[model samples]
Target chain A: MSEDDAVAGPTDDGQLVRVEGFLVRLDLAYEPDGHLWVAPPDGSTGNVRIGLDPLGVETTGTVAHLVVGSVGTRVRRGEPLGSLEAEKFVGPLVAPLTGVIRAVNPALATPRQVVEDPYGTWVAEVLPEAWEEESAQLVRGADRLPAWFADEVRRFRLEGVLAQ
Target chain B: MGPEALLETPARPGSRGSRRAGRTLGTLRVLDFGAVSPVRSQSLWHALACGVGRGSPAALALCRPAQPYVSLGYHRPLADLDLGTCRRRGLPVLRRLVGGGTVYLDPRQLFFQVVVPPDAVPAARSQAVAELLGPARAAFEAAGLPADFDQGELAVAGRKVCGHGAGLVGGAVVVVGNLLERFDAAAAAGVLWAPDAESRRRLAGRMAECVGPDPTWPVDAQAFAEGLVSAYAEAFGVTPEPGGLTPFEERVARRFDRLLGSPAFLCGPGGQSETQLTERRRAEIWTVKVRAGVVEARVVLDSTVLRAALVGGRLRDVVVEDPEGDQDPGVATALEGVTEGSPALEALARGGPSAARAAAAAARLLARARGGGE
Candidate 1:
């Protein structure tokens, strides 16, 4: 485990302590509107790994299949990098960043397995176009994440998409 | 406002509208609810539905499967089927582009596929099921079948009469389901690659009990399909308009139709070769816990031919290879006297002429029970 994967220490105030409902781990970086999370890339490798956020997994039923574009495929922001099929829905795994796909987890056995270990299963690794500039726009750190995730959960609940 | 909303729901067959109104948004295009081959009825609709998610307005298509075919969901394991038997029977086993469990489709089922933009679908999967399937459920009711979309299963009259699956493609949500006029429960059980006959029987029985289509419901395929059009229009608040497939959709569907027809389509790149089935007969022993003592049976297969029939652990009722008749009672008694993994069972395989072959076949049947470990 790298330093980026470290869990935040408990502060005396408890202002932004961990609360789980549509899990928002403080360790991962998230795209604001999309249901995606990215792991910090080490200096040695330029590829940044990405996976579906908890909310994204919960909103889609049993994932039946995962299909990805070929390596070296350049994807525009919001374009489909691949697709995830669930029992009741089939949706594109939209690109969270404008980048060339560096690698996809070739070992991905079954799409349904994502339900068990979502965070650990990185769908693809990409050479980010401008993550340095884009990271600033993402919802990161313990301070802002709780509110953002809670708001999304509430929106989903009201829309009759998520259970209360 | 969506393209369909700004323009009249049906668009009046090329009637002039505002520059912005030309986009598809409010109206739901209705396709002919006619019977088609399994490809056109199932996978083709899926390919078209996914294509519509990109930019076009939402649409619905309904059809009945013209012939028998086994379809697996995008992620379903092909190991769930007896491929050799399917092949021998001229059954085309297809892995559907959509996401769902494996199913057997024949003329008795009416299939409906719906595609809508991402914005139209709720953000939650559960809500989307309720929202999208609500129209289908209402349609079933209109067809004289009370229905509810539970999880991914559609139950009519408290039993599963329909199986539903959905997915998102190209920024759109696609949901598909069927209205069963009748179901071949035994054949469905036989084709599935399950462990023991008990489980397969349970599956068939439970499916019959919970999900199998009602054979008694007077089926009027065309009339039932028309009911769906009306229900969907009301449920989604769209006007049904007579329309045909767009040029782009036709091209996309045609491309995928050919792709879906390929043999490789049934087995993904990572799929294992017809894993458990060996060339010659492989004897496999399968034991299932029933109300009685542990009921064990041996399914002997020489390639696709069923060499022995020891279903439900009753040797008195012996069926030798695709036959439903009685064999010698003395042979059955000898087979029953020997327990699994015993020396007597091994001796039995080499003992008599015909009976000995069956005895040896039982031991080989053990492999299938353990799950295709060829």
Candidate 2:
């Protein structure tokens, strides 16, 4: 994707909010501390997809390699679902919600896809064990997302992750 | 405090999380283990990092390995290093719970580790890395080396003087770096899995040019350690307090030491087999970053292999070899000094099919080296 495609703002449906050139999808629930977004569960499969937000990809210099949890493996919120090795940094992929991993993304084969199109490239699909209780802890809704996302962008900028 | 006072202090049970939230301590704990076994050099700080929590004070641990070893990053594939070469040389290949590429370490280098609570540094990885390495740069400067920390690397005169790795380990942020009094470029290159002897030689030459400190400047290990401690104390605005490992940290270190050397851990998460690694070597462009802006790559094309050294995105010492035992000297000469992202393909088209193929492969290899995929 081109730089223009990456920085494209929210759609007319009012799902995304543009924060400092990064499109923050308000429709998805977020684990702000972990910089992960949780898509609403599929009605048929009842599995929620999880991915790193644009901000997370931006902070991690270059996505060298990604090791995601195997399918059927159980994980807890704040525990390592996997690990990401970037150019200068390495860290865990903290699970946003407790659940069993249903599937791992084929995008792991090309980590740059995750960097280029974060929203489109989901990291893993999880069969959330406590959607009602655990998802409540996530930051969601259009009402709260914009301001929170804007603040996050500002925080990253102040922290030198983004250009001032 | 003195060594006697530090050793006399009893280990506090469950004191890892004893500090109150948001409270900054006035002292930086200094654990200076002069020289230790390769595993202990890594495990000591790792244990401290794992034990850090909300109220935990930042600690700086300094040590050097008594023997040489190859340390791989936490998520790095074991295939990155030539395990047989390491084993034959009696060099233990250990993996550290940190992020960075594979490295060959020996007694000539002094290691400095900083373990702090997550909140102590910036949230952004790059920013945090730079902040953590600031004191190391200061220490090098105080030692009369014109050092600067740029893009998360400490360099002297454009050559990387210190190797660094950082990661969020458990409840703490850990940054580990080495003060290179000397670096064995040949040994460093030898440990890497290269497809051929020529490719390994090219890698070693590039490493010799791009990495390590200035040979002329003499570095006193004791003075450098003291400088690093003082630098950290000043940077954090805290007093240096001599301290030894708590019993809890010691136990964790022992566990880590065992984990670091285990065969399962050495294989890494993917359990990359030799067959898979061989396939990857055949199918992909093998590249290693000597330092920022300098890379060495070997690209294997059908019936031909192209090895090139890239300095600042421009090709240098380009070599093309065919399986029929023929070396394309003309193509190698013509391709020299070609910049990446340029029309190298069209330029080499006149040299025939094999040259054109080699140019295309070189371009892709260069792109991969620069972190820009083809």
Residue lDDT tens for model 2, B1-374: 11111111000100122112434546788999889999999889888876664345789999999999999887677878887898899999888877788899999999999887765666566666787888887788766666886555788778898899887665677889988988899999999988888889988888888788767777766767878999989888899988888887888788888888788877765466575578657766877888877778888877778888777788888888876634668888877888766676568865677777777777777667655431
Where model 2 places Cα greater than 4 Å from the true spot, the runs are A1-17, A158-161, B1-23, B273-276, B323-328, B370-374
lDDT of 1 by residue, B118-190 (tens): 5565555555656677777766776777766543456755567667776654345677888877778776666
lDDT by residue for model 2 (A1-164), tens: 34334344667877876766778998899887767899999999999999988877887668877777679989887666777766556666778899999999986777898898999999999999999999999889887887777777766565555787
Per-residue lDDT, model 2, residue B51, is 62
**Tens digits of lDDT, candidate 1, A1-164:** 23222334444555323333444567778765556788777579878888877777776655546666668888765566775655434445666677888898864545544666677788889889888887776678877677677666665565555666
Docking class of 1: acceptable
TM-score, model 1 to reference:
0.68
Question: Could you tally the backbone clashes for each prediction?
Answer: 25, 0
Q: Kindly report which residue stretches of model 1 are placed more than 4 angstroms away from their true locations once superposed.
A: A1-16, A19-23, A61-77, A98-130, A133-137, A141-143, B1-25, B195-203, B269-374
